[model samples]
Target chain A: GGIITQTPKFLIGQEGQKLTLKCQQNFNHDTMYWYRQDSGKGLRLIYYSITENDLQKGDLSEGYDASREKKSSFSLTVTSAQKNEMAVFLCASSIRLGGHAETLYFGSGTRLTVL
Target chain B: GDSVTQKEGLVTLTEGLPVMLNCTYQTIYSNAFLFWYVHYLNESPRLLLKSSTDNKRTEHQGFHATLHKSSSSFHLQKSSAQLSDSALYYCALSHTGYQNFYFGKGTSLTVIP
Candidate 1:
């Protein structure tokens, strides 16, 4: 079994500031994803990478850019933080696309607070 | 677009009692999948159950969920609720060819002693 690790569990930022969140998975899964969870709201997918250099956008991909620098690491950059934009960013990895091979495993979320 | 809805935002139950969390979904595609993910405080979200089989019961770790394709629902239930079962539960859905998954508003379940 492998684990997904996210850095800077807590983040504080100012309006218009650009911030980045990092995630690493030792599972060697081929797919990586970034999602944002707002209080009392369901998680929304921001971006996903099927392979090391592949990038795909989700419904909430705007204002965010993602890069899969390596097979184990995926990074998300908030182009500009908005005031009152407080939410938890979660990272997940999955083996493949649909069914038994398509289960996703999430990492401990990174809570971000913009002042 | 695929969407998920979990009606109750919070569910309070007594330990050793039965518990149920409702989950419903809508999708345009015929071949779709439903999933239940559990999130505990200070911990990451984990898969509790998943199923694509219509009208079939899927069980895991004492928790069970059945997909009712006719009803477009995949409600989760457990025979006995434990204090350790307190957590946030999310219902998710995805189409056969969709790259992104859609999740419902989370339901927070709290079990009291």
Candidate 2:
């Protein structure tokens, strides 16, 4: 059994400040993703990486940046934290299913509170 | 645009009652994939069920759902509700050959003991 760990379960950031969230997976999955969850809103994908050094933008990637520095880790950075922004950031990883598609295993999530 | 819709934002039911949460979707691709994810409070959402073939029932962990391509719906159902079954359920969709996922505004189920 493997686990997906996310750093800083609770984050309090200042407005306009840059915040970074980290995720590490022990499953050795090839695909990683970052998603945001706001109250009463569905999970929105911010970024997804198919392999190392590859990034795909999702609908909610405008104010975020992602990096896949290694196979076991993926990171998301909020370029400019917006005021009153409170959302849970989730990290997920999965094996590359290509045409078959695979299930995503998610981390516990990092809840962000921008003051 | 591709999207998923899960109505019934808050469903309150007594334990041991029949469970059903409505989920509908819209996509341009014919062969799209539909999925249900269960998220407990303050926890990451876990994939509960997934299916691509229409009219086929997919069951897992006492939960069952079927992807009806003709109706573009994948409604989640359970025979009996348990107090532990209370959680937020999300409906998601993806195209056949693409990896992008679009999720619906989740449904929260609260089973009272």
Candidate 3:
């Protein structure tokens, strides 16, 4: 009965500005992830953390950075927003149970638009 | 590198018809897991079905999918499509003992009344 909360559900940013999206999960899960969703492209992993203070670069992490300072929170920052960039960023977390396949619980998402 | 592929970008169907979304994957690991996730508008994307055992059909909320290791496919299907079933679907792959997962481009299903 836990929830994932993402702040600033809709975001508008200026080109070249740094934008940060925040996610907090009360699931107490050990693994957290950030994903970007485009119109046609499925969700692409931006970054992931196995535990607090850990970070793993995903396939599309070139222009993004993530922080996992606490187990309950994970934040993603766009290094420099691009003009006309628009995408929905999702945050998810999972519980690691030995060798079992973990199910991901996701936050609603942060929709970003850069002018 | 591990990856998932969902060929159909969008599917339109009348209610009461059958529904099928094709999913295929490529990975070096043998014990990889395949999943079907549904995303309804204004809701968080959630897991619909998952399978790791080859040829074992996994069903949830009237949807079913079987992971066929031989074919490298895990397609989602439903016998009766409903208007409320309209949503975006995604196929994902994850390796055993690891949390890193890869997702395919989503398939948007529109079931009209």
Candidate 3 segments exceeding 4 Å error: none
For every model in order, the TM-score on chain A comes to: 0.94, 0.96, 0.97
What CA RMSD would candidate 2 show?
Answer: 1.4
Error of 2 at A70 (Å): 1.1
Write one digit per residue (lDDT tens) for candidate 1, span A1-115: 9999998899999999999999999999998999999868789889999889999998899999999989999999999999999899999998875432378889998999999
TM-score computed on alpha carbons, candidate 1: 0.93
DockQ of each: 0.58, 0.63, 0.73
TM-score for all models, in order of appearance: 0.93, 0.94, 0.97
Looking at model 1, residue A92 earns an lDDT score of 97
Per-residue lDDT tens digits for candidate 3, residues A66-104, read 999999999999999999999999999999876644999
Q: What is candidate 2's lDDT per residue for A13-112, written digit by digit as tens? A: 9999999999999999888999998768888889999888899998889999999999899999999999999989999987757563478899999999
Candidate whose TM-score is highest: 3
Model 3, CA-based lDDT: 0.94
Candidate 3: tens digits of C-alpha lDDT, residues B10-91 = 9999999999999999999998889899999999999999988999999999999999999999999999999999999999
Question: Which residue ranges in model 1 land beyond 4 Å of their true spot?
Answer: A97-101
* Residue-level lDDT for A29 in candidate 3: 93
Model 2 chain A weakest lDDT span, ten residues long: A94-103
Better of 2 and 3 by lDDT: 3
Note the residue pairs that clash in candidate 1: none
